[model samples]
Target: MSEFDKKDVPEERIGLIDLMRTIKVVPLVTLHSPEEAVPLARALASGGVPIAEVTFRSAAALDGMRAIHDQVPEVTLVAGTVHTVDQARQAVEAGCKGVVSPAFSDAVVDWCMGSRIPVLPGTATPSDIEKAYDLGLRFTKFFPAEAYGGVKTLKALSGPFAEMSFLPTGGVGFGNAREYIDLPNVFAVGGSFPVPSKAQRQGDWKAVADACAQARQLVQG
Candidate 1:
């Protein structure tokens, strides 16, 4: 059985897509140190956004997720930048509520589906979206959003994939956040914009909180 089955999880839990829609913004985070996890999570919560997509881009990813899960339980955790099935399993073991891949990995998506774990496979083109759609997935991520045409691309996609919703990430910042979030098909925006690099490097939790609040405002407005 999967780790999720080993635990007593609620049967009627909120789906990740619905949760993301409500939150409006999902902060893509990369932790260089495990010690920053709790405070970073706390900051996110204080800023009115209590969700984090901890990317497996560093050695500290699992440890950081563990700390946030154990100490800052209110912050919803999603494993990001996943590339393989093993990493997906390790993410669930670390207490991630969902999984996000930078690209549509057949193995990872298949494993998540079999394990009943929410997965957002990345898509930058119609073909990628079509593959996820064929798998009965209506929610997916639009990666490198700006580079691939940003709002214009999403607008064009809305025509053919009207039933689909997206979490637009990459090149998403305050300036264009409102534009992305305003799109009817965009469920939420994702980026490191909410977690300022300088502030995080300095361990300035308050600045992080403020940045998150500002992002939340921008999207909500």
Candidate 2:
């Protein structure tokens, strides 16, 4: 691989991607309440998944991230559903190691690049992927994976973007997760099925952990 290839991404950025690949799954979490943040993070860690892509979909996102960062510091946290540069900055301030957006936003992507923070901007089409490549990013999030042809789409993309790898999210769950993970072009899978909604809402950490464990097994199998 050339120095500019995915294998040659900056050392710090490589570490982030390595962590994701090691875990094989990133929990796409939406905090319903700030109080559940620490416990949820711990549950994920106990379940063998220690990473979170906390979306900015809810109001508790920032405080939730802070609680996780301050309390359960072991879980690798990243911001998700980010639509603006301000959200990206807030995520970083909340101790997130990186940021993820549902769509490609120049301002957000540029801010992370300028700040030297690892980011995975969403790309659902060939044009979007090319734009990400033009920005010198080798890793990107493939959003609405199932909606836009899922595994078949990823396989087709491999031909044109041989050097680029993806973190496929949306419409991904236990039934189809292994298929995505098994793909050579996918680095990791992102979705919320690992942290069951009822488990999180009722503070049933063990149930959450069990779900996560099952997800980990799916990837291993």
Candidate 3:
């Protein structure tokens, strides 16, 4: 069980909270061209999921974020896989309102918190959650959630760190997303499901949109 906080206080910033609550399904998108970013974001938004985590796994991350920010303004874009302060700075300048990482990094978390970007710092253990809570962050991402025990772990964690809200990513997909979404402590769950690799590689924007629509319906229902 993770020993962190007692409860979460909802944030006023929609983009920030979307990183937690509404974006229960996040598209971990990595496009080859920045041009693909806007269209993809538009598709997701039109399908009812108005957000995405544009990861730094690809060279086009910043450019994609810029394009999405400019052309698909309704999509709440977040910069992900931030490993350094400079990257975080660049992401914020590119119009990302939030940041996420695959693992916990105090420096990265501090940088985002210091800046205007609200952060969903990853926390997979009790200690990680403690550090995040100490930094005044109530929301966090539980990377490799399934491998680390998933719902059972979260339920156990709630007994101690009930205040901390989570957005469990890694291994999250259509089959089990609702199990996480229904949890009071889980504000959201993120995965590559919204834009499956095969679909994106095939340039199936419609499939992406349809997937997002189905995901939205599942979470809502």
Q: Pick the candidate with the highest TM-score.
A: 2
- TM-scores of all models? 0.94, 0.97, 0.91
Off by over 4 Å in 2: 1-8
* Model 3 regions more than 4 Å off: 1-15, 18-20
Q: Which window of 10 residues has the lowest lDDT sum in candidate 3?
A: 1-10
TM-score of 3: 0.91
Number of the candidate with higher lDDT, 1 or 2 = 2
Number of the top-ranking candidate, with lDDT as the measure:
2
Instruction: For candidate 3, list the clashing residue pairs, or say none.
Output: 5-163, 6-163, 7-163
> For each candidate, what is the lDDT?
0.91, 0.93, 0.81
Clashes of each: 0, 0, 3
Model 3 lDDT, residue 143, Cα = 85
**Which 10 consecutive residues of model 1 have the lowest summed lDDT?**
4-13
Ten contiguous residues minimizing lDDT sum, candidate 2: 1-10
